[model samples]
Target: MCVWILIGLCIITKVHGYSDGDFPQSCDSLLPEHRRSGVNILPQNTKPPYKVTYKPGNNGEPITVSLESNPGHKFSGFMLEARETQRVDEGPPVGRFISLQPDTRLLTCSLSADSAVSNRYSAGKTLIRVNWTAEGAELDITFRATFVESYAKFWERVDRKVTIQTTTPPPTTQPSTAEPSTAKPSTANPSTVKPSTAKPSTAELSTTNSSPVTTSISSSTTQNTQRPDALGLKREGTVQMSLDILFVGVKMELPNIITITITNSLFSRGLIKVSNILCSLLSMAVEISAPILFCANDSCTVTLIALMCVVIVINFMDLVIVSLPIGPSHELKDICDLAAKVCSVIHMVFTIAALFVAVLEIDDCRNNRKDFWLLKVMTAFTVWICLFLIWTFVVSIHRNEILGRNKTGSSKWREQGKKNKLSAAEVIVTAVSVILIMGTLSFTVTVIAGIFLAKQTCA
Candidate 1:
């Protein structure tokens, strides 16, 4: 029994070894067939096998050739040559040839192999040669083949159909003409016609008389007209009156009036729209960044709210300014007047609101350093924007004044003032006002630039 048990254990071990065996017999047993064929079953450190595959006879179309390397060897590149001979111009003799060099891992060449084969060789035979080289291989591989028909002949039939269609012309029809009438007209004597001249037709008489009467009326009217033939006026006085009215209308709507109105309207609206959008986005961004810059405290939120209030005022002012119309003549003047009034009201309101917000922010920022810096910047920006608004209003008012004075008397204020001004108080007031306006514009521009830079840096 012990011997039987030991033998059984040994049998189990043998079965396990066979199940997990490394040397697979199925492949190893094919060595004899490989030897009989004289082909290497496994070649080590040998040149990779290069084979060229081509479809011939145009295959009813173009012929494409590709090169494939043996497994475990990468396809580096290939050179393709179409020649009459197979051995590099040594055998048979080459006719027309084309060579291709593809510096790629897999190379392919498609030849329009529709040309007739030379009679010296087969009717539809062409020799394709491919030389391939792979990385880490010493010997280059060469592939050769003679292509023949191996695909459906569709292109030939298509070509024949195209040729027939191109050669054919459309059929045309000949036009038919009407035949002459065969019936003859009846002939009667003058006696049979009897005195059959119908009663005198009023229509014919009226037609005959119409032309002379119309001509007489036209001549009389032409003589009575007093204007030149070119202007078609009844009298010279009427022509002068028409010219006066035309000139007056043109003067009322002068070119400069229309141009300046359009330019100012577009400029103001464009600036307002752009500034509003930017300011709104900036306000939202500041709100979002409040927590990051300052701790989530009461004072920080107050400061942010104060800053946002100032932005709201500025945005409101921009909207009001943009809504004003600057257009043709009277309409533009009316709009300008309305805008000036609305602007003055809004400016006063914004100024008061901004001052209140600035005071609140200053109080809030006393407890937070970050909030203090932010509020300080906000205060400066608000003051700058207010000053700019005021300066713009002053410029608009001044322009209106200049236009009004010019219209009243065709004299400019600058020239007239230079000639007549003599008061020191007036000169001092003018100098101070100009300086203030210029200073305001410069300060506003500088603040705007600084704010833009700060935002960019923070971003």
Candidate 2:
């Protein structure tokens, strides 16, 4: 039973960690059949079984060729050559002779210049040759090739294909024209045509007299002037559509919005959503951490709750500030922005402290199952809160430039500001932003370390 259990465990480990379930068994799968058929050469096995791996490289990277031999058999040394199959350009043969280390089971080498391979990856193939001495026999492998394509080249091809696909309109069928009417004209029309000598009806006379006035009015139609914001609306629509397409993948959970009304709505709802999530995490953390932390020092729990309340208030303030309209002067906007920046700093400080405290509490949590799980939950919440905080900080930094500023206007004030060294306030804001980012990072690291330490202690 123990033997079978050990065997099962080995099988599970191999399947989960080491086995390549669906990967190609050989280098033959690297290129299309036509490309592989003519170039692939089966290496001679004069001594024992071995495997060869071919890896095509990308820009600024080298092509890797490796050989692995069975135990008690290995290649002593090898010569390799690689050249582009289609010789539109002439260059030095990309080949080298590599000596294997003594008793080494595996030997690998890079062929061709990394720069050259990068430059000629698209529609390029490197014909390779290998010759080696093993088991007192010299064996050679010739003409094996791998297709090469840099990631940049691959994306370029994709873009070209996408452009072509988008631009090519679907096949359209012309509406068939009806055959020309062939019925002859009425027989009596030409000879029996009569000219009426009657006086015109009153309505017809009135319409004729009124027709000139109507015609004059119609001919003198005024063109409606475009609204001042019409062009702005068109540009906004275009930009919004572009963003919607770009973020369609991730928009389900975290949506991107650009329009004024929609952006305001998103922020209002997002603030609530973020606050609820944070509150849930805080409650979980408090519950899990109470035994380890609150029991020893109840002040820490009160401090955490109080910090959470302050954070909630700050978030509420942010939502309010964001919801506010831009007043006649930019002063109100700047003030709101400044408030948000300050709030971010305060939030960062508390968040970092909370994470640190939670992690510290986990030192006592190793023996208690409840304590262990709760600490983990708290750590997770702290990480999430830190992530949201960082995002808020970044958004605050770029909010004015992206969403509030006039794109086309020239600002002498900004030019002068740039000419002058940054003001004390600007310097302070910059310093705080940097500090906030660093604190968030440190807090995240603390949470991760706390989790690691707890796991190690449990183990």
Q: Candidate 1 deviates by what RMSD?
A: 37.1
Per-candidate TM-score against the hidden true structure? 0.23, 0.24
Candidate 1 structure, TM-score to reference: 0.23
Let me know the TM-score candidate 2 reaches against the reference structure: 0.24
Number of backbone-clashing residue pairs for each candidate, in the order shown = 0, 0
lDDT of 2 by residue, 1-459 (tens): 999999999988875331211112222222222223456443332422434454322221222344444564433222223332342123333333221111111112222221111110112222222222221222222323222222211111000000001121222111111112211222335543221111223335545545645543442231012211212222222222222111211111122121222324446456534543443344334333333333233113444445445544554554455456554356575676467456545644554454444443333323233555545555565565555556555655774454333533323335566534444444444454455444534544444554555444433
- Looking at model 1, report the run of 10 residues with the lowest lDDT sum: 154-163
Model 2 misplaced stretches (Cα beyond 4 Å): 1-300, 327-331, 366-446
lDDT per prediction?
Answer: 0.32, 0.35
Q: Which regions of candidate 1 deviate over 4 angstroms?
A: 1-325, 328-332, 344-352, 359-404, 407-434, 441-459
